[model samples]
Target chain A: GAGVSQSPRYKVAKRGQDVALRCDPISGHVSLFWYQQALGQGPEFLTYFQNEAQLDKSGLPSDRFFAERPEGSVSTLKIQRTQQEDSAVYLCASKRTGRETQYFGPGTRLLVL
Target chain B: AQSVTQPDIHITVSEGASLELRCNYSYGATPYLFWYVQSPGQGLQLLLKYFSGDTLVQGIKGFEAEFKRSQSSFNLRKPSVHWSDAAEYFCAVGPKTGAGSYQLTFGKGTKLSVIP
Candidate 1:
């Protein structure tokens, strides 16, 4: 079975540029999550979605960070005017309904120069 | 708010040696604890989780964690660690919600270096 997968495994962007990271969760997964991991640090929650509805986005750092799962399957995390501080590995995870374990994706490594 | 702590930033152990990784968490209520492993350039892999019931929980790759509510700790251990066990270990606490969401607050991680 395919686990969660993210597109653009590596992204290099200049400051002030915008980037979009995509995540494809497992088929039939009802819950999706996004997290950011800095160098030598653990992943931090960014946003969560239950189907097409985003339930928690409190972990989004700023307005520049926005995510949406419009069709209830694929989700996108967009960063506007990318900054050096926004450089990190963005991870995606998904889980089945009524399950607690989360399967993670390989993640997109974003580097803002 | 809610937070997790991995006291050891790094640990070195010889292959076939017993190993233990410390983790502690703070939450207002009963917390859901988890352990995850990450290899270089890889996604986080679930090792084990303790939501309730038995304090001792077993996971993949011969890993286990003991959740101690009195100490607010969930430490991961292995009877004998293999060289492949060298990786970054993370401790996380999931705040229970009425909606049954699994949002995790993670620790800084402990890097394990296994010696041959």
Candidate 2:
């Protein structure tokens, strides 16, 4: 009954610093998604994975944003040389195979100073 | 490209009053629509989703939504809203890609405020 969970609920990074956000999806979930949400805005898709395969990375803003799900369970979103424009909440969601509904995690709030 | 729109940026309603939140979407085909609620510092919670068949779908917390194909709209409603219903509501559309994958596009979100 465990839902998706993210680590470092709050992260404060200086400009030009790199940060890594972690996510743990539900057990047996085959599909994972990452989204970015700005203040007073809805979440926007960033990337998607299906069992260790990165299916979609089109939503990623730039080369600085990279994600990987190596073992098909845990996922990590990395941002290199964090910038003020990159400050936002990063959310993780997971869904079972053949299911449309996705369960979301608490999200990691990243602030660039 | 698929997109969702929430016309109302904010709505205020009294407790026990009926409530309705408007949502519109634009897609090439019949898209999968969903309503999600989010509290402050929390993740999104699914309210209801409309795929096919019935135009009316019921969800948790006494929430319901009606999908109108002609209008390209999926509006959320409740007969009587509780104070706890005050939160941010989002409308999203999911479109299937050529690779057999699905991607969701969400609206700007509507903030609901309840008064006693």
- The TM-score obtained by model 2 is 0.98
- What lDDT score is found at residue B53 in candidate 2? 91
Write the residue-wise lDDT of candidate 2 on A3-37 in tens digits.
88999999999999999999999999999999999
lDDT of 1 by residue, B1-116 (tens): 88888999999999999999999898988877889999999999999888889999999999999988899889999999999999999999886665546788899999999999
Off by over 4 Å in 1: none
Candidate 2 docks at the CAPRI level of: medium
Candidate that scores best on DockQ: 2
Fnat for the candidates in order: 0.78, 0.73
The residue pairs that clash in candidate 1, if any, are: none
Quote the positional error of residue B31 for candidate 2 in Å: 1.0
Q: TM-score for all predictions?
A: 0.97, 0.98
Q: How large is the C-alpha RMSD of every model relative to the true structure?
A: 1.1, 1.1
